[model samples]
Target: MFQKILIANRGEIALRVLRACKELGIQTVVVHSTADADAMHVRLADESVCIGPPPSRDSYLNIHQIVAACEITGADAVHPGYGFLSENAKFADILAAHNITFIGPSGDHIRIMGDKIEAKRTAKRLGIPVVPGSDGAVTEEKEAKRIASEIGYPVIIKASAGGGGRGMKVAHTEADLEVALQTARSEAGAAFGDDAVYIEKYLQKPRHIEVQVFGDGFGRGVHFGERDCSLQRRHQKVWEEANSPALNAEERSRIGSICATAIADLGYSGAGTIEFLYENGEFYFIEMNTRLQVEHPVTEAITGIDLVHEQIRVASGGGLSVKQEDIKFNGHAIECRINAEDPRTFTPSPGTITHFHTPGGLGIRVDSGVYSGYRIPPYYDSLIGKLIVHGRNRVECMMRLRRALDEFVVDGIKTTLPLFRDLVGNADIANGDYDIHWLEKYLAKEE
Candidate 1:
């Protein structure tokens, strides 16, 4: 086991990794920007270092400063918690060159899976089910039109290396495809520095599901079932639940086995997620997140597994402690991403939190990085905390989540709490009859 590990990010996830390290008897070193010098993670870590200013490019995303901090703190490993350089392949290679372990997939694996187009090809070659689309990058508009025609209408043009709902455009017809192709290519180039875009069949109202997989470097891998992330807004997940109500036992088993085999075939190591889009009782591969996901707590709630600890064990040359049969899903779990935003206008509200109150008791867990006086900076993501709840079933889970959301209070700034309150109380959500577009339509009705 590593004696010390450096956390290369901040916010709620940073604190999460710190707690995991403490339980494993590993000292933690947290690196923060100038604005986060007094953040919760910094206060809880055994050591803290200031990397740079508030700008992410000079701070959280600065690879050199983070590596220097790891060296100064004598951390044997670096754990990137979800964002920033967590999925950057170059950063992983740099750490490897410095003889420091990266608590995620290898540099090669990250590079391979980071590119959406390449990942699709890899999955197809491995016999994993993938959505019908362009075979490779569509460099010319003429080629894009050809591919779009072959795939039929209602296709999506996506950047080869895009995420977070950016660099994507949906075309419903031939005319829309031609115009969307040009605009998508330009946007992809500007956003991801890659002008390459690919076409894929767009499944309307699909249920967003993902399977979490963990692999030891020695070629052993296992899955932790699936998370129903169907509740989304603008292609971004809002609420995630484990033991998806939409998947049957046979379907779950098939997807889980396919995901594990795909990861093992790729020689993937550490923690990763294979995302899928399910519609009309058919599943299609979307993309794989090469690092821990924001909604991972929901999976942990049902599996009784510490994913962070598992990542550490894998990086330390330890095999998986649990097999496929050992994994058992018990109860339903839900996670709501609490962000600093107005529920009505959906605009960011960054300010000081005058009074903060978190819900507690059985079946409720809150992962947060701010205290009563912490001011939310507008320079980064709006997410402030995660509210996770578990119950014996989906009905009970929904009720518990609603109760928890009502109790969660953060004054001096508007939060998404009201949004969640309205979400959990909806009849569709309560009945587990919702698709990706359900939230948008629901919000539209409120307007």
Candidate 2:
């Protein structure tokens, strides 16, 4: 086991990793930016290091500074708690070169899965079903049109190197394809520095389902069911739940098994998520995140498994603690991302949180890094915390979430609390009759 682990990130996730390390009796050295000197993770860690200034490029994303922290702290391993360098292959390689373990998948897997084009091709080669469209990037308009024609109308253009909905455009008809292609390419170029886009058949009202897979790095793995992250706005997931309301027992079993088998076959290690788009009883591979996801808390709530601990143990050359058959999915779990944004306009709201009172009681879990007086730096993501709840079933879970959301408070800055408050009473939400665009459409109607 790793006696000392350096956490190479900040905010709630960094705190999340810190708690996990404490549970395993491991010492943690949290690396933070100047903006996060008073952050909870930094304050609670066994030791702390200020990597650099507030800007991500010089701090959270600084490879050399992070490596230097590891060297100075004598950390045996580094755990990137999602975002930042979690999926960065070069960072993983650098850690390996320093003889320090990266508590995630091998760099090779990260590189392969990080590229959208290569990942799609790899998924198809692995016998996993993929969306019908061009086999590779369509650099030419003619090629894109041809693929659109063959795949029928209502095609979507996606960046070959994009994620988080950037560089993505949907065309409802042939006439819209040209504009969508151009828009997708331009956005892709600006966001990912790669204008290369691919065409695929777009499913109307698709549900975003992702399987959580964990590998012990020795050809053994397990799948801890799935999460319904379909509740998104502008391609960013806002609310997530484990044991999707859309899937039946058989569907869940089939997809989860396939995801687990693929992880074992590919020799993947640590924690990873295989995301899919489901429509009309069919699942098409979207992509694979080669590190822990932000919504991992929902899976942990339902499965009673500590994913961070698993990742750390596997990276330390330990086998998995549980098998597929030994695992049991207990209840439905839901996670709501509470960001410092306007509930109505969704504009960024960053400042000092003068007052903050998290909800308590049964089935309520709040993972946050800020306190009542903490200043939310404007230089980073607007997310301030996550509220996760678990119940014996979805009904209980929804009700518990409603109560918890009502009790929670974060004053002195606008938050999306009003939005979630609105959702709690919506009938569609109660029935779980929503797709990826459901929240967007709801917001449009409200506007």
Tens-digit lDDT track for model 2 on 40-95? 99889999999999999999999999999999999999999888999999999999
lDDT of 2 at 85: 96
TM-score of decoy 2: 0.99
Candidate 2 residues lying further than 4 Å off, grouped into runs, are none
Considering only N, C-alpha and C atoms within 3 Å, which residue pairs clash in candidate 2? none
lDDT of each: 0.91, 0.92
* Predictions: Cα RMSD each: 0.9, 0.9
Model 2 poorest 10 in a row by lDDT: 136-145
Instruction: Give the distance in Å from residue 113's predicted Cα in candidate 1 to where it truly belongs.
Output: 0.7
lDDT of 1 by residue, 262-305 (tens): 78877788999999999988899999999999999999999999
TM-score of 1: 0.99
The parts of candidate 1 lying over 4 Å away from their true place are none
